[model samples]
Target: MNKAQVVEAVVLAKKAKQLTWESIASTLGMSTVWVTSACLGMNSMPEQAAEKLCELLELPSEAKSVLMEYPTKAWSPAIPQDPLIYRLYEVVGVYGDTLKEVIQEKFGDGIMSAIDFSMEVEKQPDPKGDRVVITMNGKFLPYKAW
Candidate 1:
């Protein structure tokens, strides 16, 4: 498939799997909107971004190599002119309270930094519920001391 087609496929797969853009974007150290746009063919993936996308989607080596070539246009015509930040905001609208509680529980007072973080997922069996365990490690940056 072509670059746009590949991007579209990845985005569809992500949505089909019910994976959050924030989760994926945090792993890539990129804004959620950029990654979402890149995966939806709304924005071009630079060499590094393409590599990261390939890795995220587990694309084959050959397909990953092909994506590095510059495309004719930087973005697809179908993309809206308005910023995708609104879409991200919509996610917060749905889950903001739950996320805030979880974040506060995990890291105490501060927020998790997408910039300095890593994530790993593993399957764990449980009688109560089938579990998908996600572990995240981010550098904790305390607020400036007074």
Candidate 2:
């Protein structure tokens, strides 16, 4: 099936199961807006996100594998005008610089490449402040010349 059909199917199933977008988004560690846009076909699902969605929705193995296939193009030709992606962009616009600086400080001169990483999160309790600790491990591979 196509992306839109997959999205529509998931949304329909979610509604029938009385599931909330917040629940799904939190489970996926994504913003509700992003999940919503993906469900409505306004945004394409990245492979990782698509795999998570397939698992959450209890799709068949074939469908799950299909959803995880890499797309031919890096970016979709049809950019979303959805409020969700727009709001995400607004958040990036406002806080992206601060986030970048913090990330650089923590990781030194490189990025945490999503393609080569694993992430785990845990909740830690403290008297002063409760914290959600996220640990990401990635292979540190420098770019090489051909």
Candidate 3:
């Protein structure tokens, strides 16, 4: 099975098993975000994790190999149309320059390394409305001055 097929199988298995990403991650001893990303075919899973995930999801053995394959990391160049995703794009568009300026001032001519990054999503309850909090942690990579 290819990554897309594996992803479809995983999603179906997850729904059929009534498993949450948190539960799956806990069983695999991995972070929820990372586990979800791997299952969704964004990141390659480690051999052990892939095996364990396949076992947990009752997926075919071939899925393990597909889960471990490195992704091409490509996406559509056009702006996403989904509201949630478009909101993220809008946030970046609005804050990109401000974040760039602040980060450069603090860390010099550098960029955050998404390759070495982690993110978490949390919920904060409020009387008005529940709030979603997202935290991203990434390594700062400085530009080579040569």
Q: Residues 1-146, candidate 2: write the lDDT tens digits.
A: 77556656787779877889888878888877557656666555677777887788776555554455444434454645898767757776898888767777766655556556555556799899997675666665444556
Q: Estimate each model's TM-score.
A: 0.42, 0.44, 0.97
Best by lDDT: 3
Order of candidate numbers by lDDT, starting with the best: 3, 2, 1
Residue 29 accuracy (lDDT) in model 3: 97
> For each candidate, what is the lDDT?
0.67, 0.67, 0.96
Best by TM-score: 3
If ranked by TM-score, best first, what sequence of candidates would result?
A: 3, 2, 1
Q: What is the Cα-based lDDT of residue 37 in candidate 2?
A: 54
Quote the lDDT for 66 in model 1.
52
> Global lDDT for candidate 3?
0.96
Residue runs of model 2 more than 4 Å from their true location after superposition: 20-65, 71-85, 116-146
Tens-digit per-residue lDDT, 96-143, candidate 3: 999999999999999999999999999999999999999999999999
Stretches of candidate 1 off by over 4 Å are: 65-146
**Pairs with backbone N, CA or C atoms under 3 Å apart (clashes), candidate 2:** none
**Candidate 3: Cα lDDT at 93:** 99
